[model samples]
Target chain A: MDLSLIIMQLFSGIALAAVLVITALGLTIVFGMLGVVNFAHGALFMIGAYAGLYLASLTGSFWWGLLLAPVLVGAFGMLIEFVLVRRLYGRSIDDPLLLTFGLSYILVEGVRIVFGSDGIPFPTPPQLIGVVDLGVGFFPKYRLFVIALVAVVLLVLWLMLERTRVGLIVRAGARDPQIMRVLGVDIGKVWLAIFGLGVGLAALGGVLAGPMRSVNPEMGTLVLAEAFVVTVIGGLGSIVGAVVAGLMVGICISMVALFAPEMATIVMFALMAAVLLVRPQGLFGLKGRA
Target chain B: MPVYETKSRPAGLSRRKAMMAMSAGVAALAMPRLGRAADDTIRIGFPTPLTGPFAAEARDQVKCAELAVKLVNDKGGIGGRKVELLVRDDKLNAGEAATRTLELIEKDKVHAVVGALSSAVQLAVNEVTRARGVIYVSISQSDTINEVKDFSKFTFHEALNPHMTTAAVARQTLKKGMKVAHLVADYAYGHEMLRGFKRAQASIGAESVGEILHPFGAADYSTFMPRLMSMRPDVLCISNFGRDQANAIKQAVDFGIKQQMKIVVPVILHNQRLAVGADVFEGVVGGANYYWGLETQNKTAAEFNKAFRTANGGAIPTDYGAYGYSGVGSLLQAMQVAGGTDTEKVVAALEGLQYDLTKGPQHYRKCDHQSVQSVLVLESKKKSAMANENDLFAIVANDPGADEMLRSCSELGHAT
Candidate 1:
């Protein structure tokens, strides 16, 4: 009702928006380039969080945890691709999704068994502890840092894809893998790189999420559904669409919480339904991609 | 409920015979001991959650039970027999609990059983115990465990039921002149607490605006907050558990609802304060069966608390530990009084027997087989009010007698 309260809520909404955009980025990139849906992305995200916790706890440095979480998660993804996902490369598309879905359970329950089924406290650093004062508003500094950090990661990711030879090759592969192969590009390495990149994005999301939420075994399972919805609404292969849609879903969810709080989660799903109804290919998706 | 279908004690202490044994004690003394060992070990089955959310609370209960067994054996073993604790993990699931209970009774041949946490699991196990005509000591506070279920002749509740817990908290809140609304988990304990609070709400001239049933294991409580604040109730009676309780309170704080409405948790939210931070938990009122910092005259309770904290490596919920210790403790006393492993006499002796609590100087009311003692009723500590880290609680009220607040065995109707 008050000016200050609404201002704070808006800031909170933006913070959540940042997290959503970053999470969806990984999935969107994979869907956009691969022409295959990856159901195990959520599980990859969870592995990143646990890896961060385990390694950080062992090393006594949060920064190391943050840096290595994505790498370890990416490595795990690489392994999964090698042992299992590689087999599905020439097979039906649904097989990959089904394999990943099964893998997700194994990952979730494996972590539960390893960690002992309980939520553990994963604290933000003392430097990011207090509320940062904005002239007419204030927000949790760690959350603001998260928003800023993810934004930087997104910028760097865009640069890597747009300003590099690898990006050019990947874009061509996305257009037509056969044409790229005809042009003498090594498609195997490109596929591996794309898989690794997708997993890295999921890992980044997990690392970013460690402090914001409880570092429990099933933390990623909670957000898996919303991440999928964000991918769909943004268009499976559209990075720009995933970005806009993630923020859209984020702000919409927060705003919905203001009035019908319980329905906030359902609001995201409803938004996806509406988007699909309006544009089956998503906001920025290609007709051919569908 | 699995029916192993052991032959019932033939000359039955059928109410007609039970009425006769209550006074005479002659046939009961002559009653045979069904299960006894050459090593003189009488096993008490502990069907508890050792791996889930109940693990922490249940672990304390288990430790306390172990301590009680040690104490009983030290003071000349129960009826000159050593007490063996048979622990089976039920995963806090109802079906698992029932299956484990049957395993404990039939395979393990445990004479008595102690179940910790999980109302559904406790209820399920209670049925199995009744059929086996074996003693059941349930540590869960759910009232339906005592009120709705067919309590076998062998069942004896060891802790205060939900009615006793909520009614007392309701009276306390209403006495301070607060209008109330219930924010509960959509489960048995939640429903029972709401009913008891509603009854007390009426008794104290307080009104109920409405009830909001939040799903358990909720990650956020933004939806419940607006309803709580919109209702404009003086007190929001929360009977939610673990993560839901933490998220609900934290969201209320973040959304600026805490300043708008007074929050009242009927049952204490265990281990959540530490998770959410002590400052965030400040000023929310709730009732717990026991507090780690009770500072009571009961040396055993004091020692148990100190020992548990030393062993647990963190703050332990006193309620769970007390129930666990007392469940095994009472059985040991019954066996001791019976002078052997005689089921009928041990059951007879335990029916109306009360233990001198090691935690506090109180008695377990033999009437409803519920503990008659003080409860930890405190508002969360504001940083400004803190005398020390452990001194977070401001003991509002001790627990009421079980018979006074709880529905009795006869009132709950019969199983046998």
Candidate 2:
């Protein structure tokens, strides 16, 4: 293989990883903080893409869609948490799982009914339509934008979690909700905000991804599986773990695809299995978290 | 709220008389109506993926089939017996396709079966329909289905096989010593298309630089892009269907591969072209079973297009959707020619039956029951050239059902 080709492939892998990181981050936070397995996370991601596409068409600007899609979808997520997910908090673990699984079907079907089952094209913004000539090879400008955006999101997320009072309470609540309540914090409200934030991240990922992939009702089905794999391989709730595992899975898939293309999809599952065998709680998960 | 006395009955009848009438109506509605003898209607089972990656295409197929049914009934429907279409969703899985096909045969008692969109799903449907001696007109492209092992007297292929379409496409596109590479979907359809392309390449003296097989419904093709770029082939042959095709082409353009080489798809879908828009698809060459632009050249195609548009809010019939129209139209035409819906009579009537319901004249080859029809070589129109949103392709070339383009009988393991 040519050295330049290898360099390009590695960069492509990182571009893929950027998408996985953002999507998986949502799943990890919701699972970690709320202890609810959000099977509808993929549906939320799909809804975000549709919402963005609809808004972009309505507003006549891709930027408006980008700015408003996550906010709108986040508000929707907050409503879901309040009206439906809140009722399942004290119930069996399977309750939320089953509820979200059914919710996924309803949401996907709802989109199908409204938008039709066909994939709708979302064009890359005019500013990002062309390629950027990297030293090794040319890459799509939109993809480069996505990678930079994800890096910025990670930095902002880190700063907010480590420095802000809300972040402190969120972190403390994830560790021990009862103690936070005893300390005069409204843990219920905190959970609602966290769920909103998590799904908002998913929506952001969707908005970014629409131009790259086909935007359809079932678009989230495969991504949901891939996101779950990333979340599992990363520790259940560890944010940094998601970043590392996302990149690892992405690179593994890309390299395997180069040599043995048939094994690309399977390689990620193999990585997850290998990781679980060594540390069942995931790469960065605390002991007993699983 | 006002309430009536419990014992009072309506002026029309007494309570006992009403109860008796209602019971009789319930019994009549509940009675199981089985077989063509119960009601003088010909039931044809139409199964396609309704909820998977191919849902949009499948829905279009259903629409086309419905149009065919309506056209037949409008014309008095095969000797005054109405036609009934029993539709089912195969869900794009082989197992589910088999199960749905069985139900269509046993429960619905359809005289014939039609419409499985995916190559693998069609085979599963063929297995069930062929065993029961039900006439099955498959509208999916696949080479293996035409082989002696899979072909049956009752099996009729209304869609062009991979060999025919690829040969038509390759002959039109390939040049001597040109380098070609393939990105194939890892399934029956993809493998057969690659084989067909390779055969065509060998005949044209083109060099096969590289080939990579990716899983079906693969969302990302970036991982394979680097290696493909490294190959530096003159043409990149993408052998996938549905969203996979759209994504691969979109990403190939994204990676600047389009600037280096031509991209050729074995099968290009109308709905997919519309969804992805004309910009990404521009200049891409491929073969199609039907193109609405053929309306200009063929009277039958013009009529079909007008009827389809009238029924579907002015949307043109898709390539795969045309298969549904042709498949059901041909089957019903055969029944009319035979003067009845008997399996043997219909089979005999369908063999070598020539008709031009859509896309000009076509006939089912007697040797393998494969539809001998024109293959359209289409080029995606530039955004500026498109007259309307649906004017996505310009017909570059037309292979008008030349016998030489199809595989010989012996080659398909059929006795000459």
Candidate 3:
């Protein structure tokens, strides 16, 4: 109830929101552009963490992991798009969803087979090991870094989507793929790149999250569900919607946890339901977009 | 030719008669095979979660149990019959555990059932095994399992329950007038641990500041961290297990809550410490059923450690892994004493049975079948002090007063 405590709680919510935004961004973009509901997004996130852990060990630097994990996982995503996802494009919307669902299981089981089920420790970078005196209260430096990193990512994403030619094609494709095809956009290649980028963003979220949470085979299962909730609440394909909804859900959970810890997990779903009842297309979703 | 004609005479008989003769022959062949299987091997059903969040601990348990089976076989087997292990994945669900236990009983015809990792899962397994009148040696921590309502004559608890563990831990750490807060996982095990801690607090006169119940397998604890910090308690008692414990502790450290208050987990797992790293777990104290470090002091522990290391590529047995080893090892030993695997006789042999397979001296309490053994109070070693990756904790205390720590039989609703 203290003002300082409330301020600290708000900061904690932002830190949580940072994680949600980065993770849900991938799902939003994939659904927005390719019209594919990727059930494998969570597995990709897990692979990203594992990839980061392995790469950090091999290169002896967490920085390299932060740099290369997303790239490697993104390449893997591109491969998946080429081999399996590409064939399902013109088919039933359920085709890609089901394929990705099965893909998630295979990826999780495959990781279990290779790495075993034990959670591997991913240490925080030495520089971010301690707490920062935030005037109201002390907070973990790593968390502040995450918040800042998410902001940078959001800005870069906004500039790219708004200013770059690739962004125009992606937005156009999302609106009308046939028009882009008529405009000689080669939408297939654009879809592949967008898939890779979306998956890479998910990997980035995983790498950032590994230090804060356990990195294991089933680590992504819960995150996947929460990410879905965020995407749905934000309007499935809206990047801006994901960012706004992520913050709203994060604060809602943290505030609810302060009063009733038992209802923290349920608060997000309740918020989503409330939003959908009033605006069926989500907060930022255009009419008939879903 | 006469012999052939004699044989052919039955064949030349009515076709119905020949079919009946063949059917009888097949029944005679199949009946003995089932009888021979029962005669040749003593099957012990091992049900535990091998697919969920706790799969790592469960798999280690299977390995430890396998080692026990191997040791029994090496010792000329149990009454000259081989001990067979039937392992099943309970999937960490109570319903799944009950179904698997039933299959192990009805289909596999296991003589005894051993192994369940979670407290809730074990209760479900106990129900199935008890109704079937089969011996069940539960390797999970649960206070409810020993109560008269859930307890059965055939049920035996090999792992230390939450009461013994929490009381032992609290006695060593808590003091008069200290402010304490509890972060409990909302489950049977968590609630039991909370009860134990509250009892300890009542005796010690520690002030209860706040209590928060989080869902099991929660991915983020940050939402609850600010609230916990707001309470500003002197000590925080975390009542959770497996990945939940690991994440809670890690996040507590992340939020700098460790600097504000001491964190005590009622039952800290070996795998959790390894997964979270020494730095995050440093200075956190808790009770463990077994610590491999006990080998230095207890000869029996040393022997068990040597054998376990030899069989497991030198990897030491974890706290829960020790449960698997001791649970199965003691059951087989009781069978050896009873001369066979009869449920009544083995049950008798197990009651008041004394052994030191992993931890120091231990025995099964006659009243509730709870394993009366030492609870090792362990403090996670600092990164600099750790000799190896496996050397995670330093034993602070080895309390042998387990009998005193248990709830009285009358209190457990058992007739005194």
Residues B119-217 of candidate 2 have per-residue lDDT tens digits of: 889889999988999999999887578899999999899999889889889988899999999999998889999999999999989999999999888
lDDT of 3 by residue, B7-117 (tens): 565445887776676677677766865785567688999999998988888988999999999999998898899998889999999999999999888877899999998
> Which ranking of candidates, highest DockQ first?
2, 3, 1
lDDT of each model, Cα atoms only? 0.73, 0.90, 0.90
Model 1 C-alpha lDDT per residue in residues B178-285, reported as the tens digit of each score: 667777777777777777788778778888887777655655454444445556787878887666676667656554556656778877654666555665677788
Better of 1 and 3 by lDDT: 3
In every candidate, what fraction of the native interface contacts is reproduced?
0.04, 0.70, 0.76
Please write out the lDDT profile of model 3 over residues A1-290, one tens digit for every residue.
78988888898899999988999999999999998999999999999999999999999999999999999999999999999999999899999999999999999999988998899999998889889998988889999999999999999999999999888888899889999999888999999999999899989999999999978988888788888889888888999899999999889988888888878888999999999999888988877876
Off by over 4 Å in 2: B1-32, B35-37
Q: What is the DockQ of each candidate?
A: 0.12, 0.76, 0.65
Displacement of the residue B350 alpha carbon in candidate 2, Å: 0.7
Tens digit of lDDT per residue, candidate 1, span A1-290? Answer: 65654556566677777867877888888777876578888877878878887778888877899898898788777787778887887688799889988998888789878886556656666677656566544456777888899889989888888999888899889889998898899887788888888898898888777766656656676667778898889888899898899889877876676665546667888999999999999898898665
Per-residue error for A163 in candidate 1, Å, reads 7.4
lDDT of 2 by residue, A49-71 (tens): 99999899999999999989999
TM-score of each: 0.76, 0.95, 0.94
